[model samples]
Target: MEDIIDKRMVDQSEMSYTVDILNKGVGQVAKKLLEESSELAFASVEQKSTADIVHEAADLIFHFLIMLKATGLTLNDVSEELESRHKN
Candidate 1:
């Protein structure tokens, strides 16, 4: 996913949503993360189908990766934090 994002960013393809959000800067990325999270929360609260929940979850995670990239972080950084907590 990071590779795809980097390629899209470099290619600057007008058709790529990743490029669009990244071009808009971190604020837009954060806004999208909030939006996706809200959709996931709504799906859960409304007792939507499992598929709906999973779909929303995937959206949230994809945006999360975008957010991490925008912030110069990576999944490994996040995993390390989680691992530290697990050991605590």
Candidate 2:
């Protein structure tokens, strides 16, 4: 799945696509993530199982990567920031 995502991202990048396309894609992904997160939050309030929360969290992370790619950033950049923050 990651490989497929990477390939699509590379193809999009190589095509010199417009920022609008990226923005739209990111916006949609953000909406989905927000919805999922809200559901997860509500589930927490209702004392739902950890498994459900974990599943939603994973969905959020996956969408986050799509958002990052849409913004022309790579996972490596995010990883580097996390590493730097860890050092601090």
Task: Give per-residue lDDT, candidate 1, residue 70.
Answer: 93
lDDT of 2 by residue, 1-88 (tens): 3455677655775553233345477777677668867877787788778998788777667666667776678788989999999899
Listed in order, each prediction's TM-score against the native is: 0.89, 0.63
**Count of clashing residue pairs in every prediction:** 0, 0
What's model 2's TM-score? 0.63
Regions of candidate 1 where Cα sits further than 4 Å from its true position: none
Deviation of model 1 at 68, angstroms? 0.2
Reference-based lDDT, residue 77, model 1: 97
Q: lDDT of each model, Cα atoms only?
A: 0.92, 0.69
Q: Which regions of candidate 2 are displaced past 4 Å?
A: 8-24
Compose the digit string of candidate 1's lDDT tens values, residues 1-88. 8788778878874568998887799999999999999999999999999999999999999999999999999999999999999999
Give the C-alpha miss distance for residue 2 in model 1, angstroms.
2.4
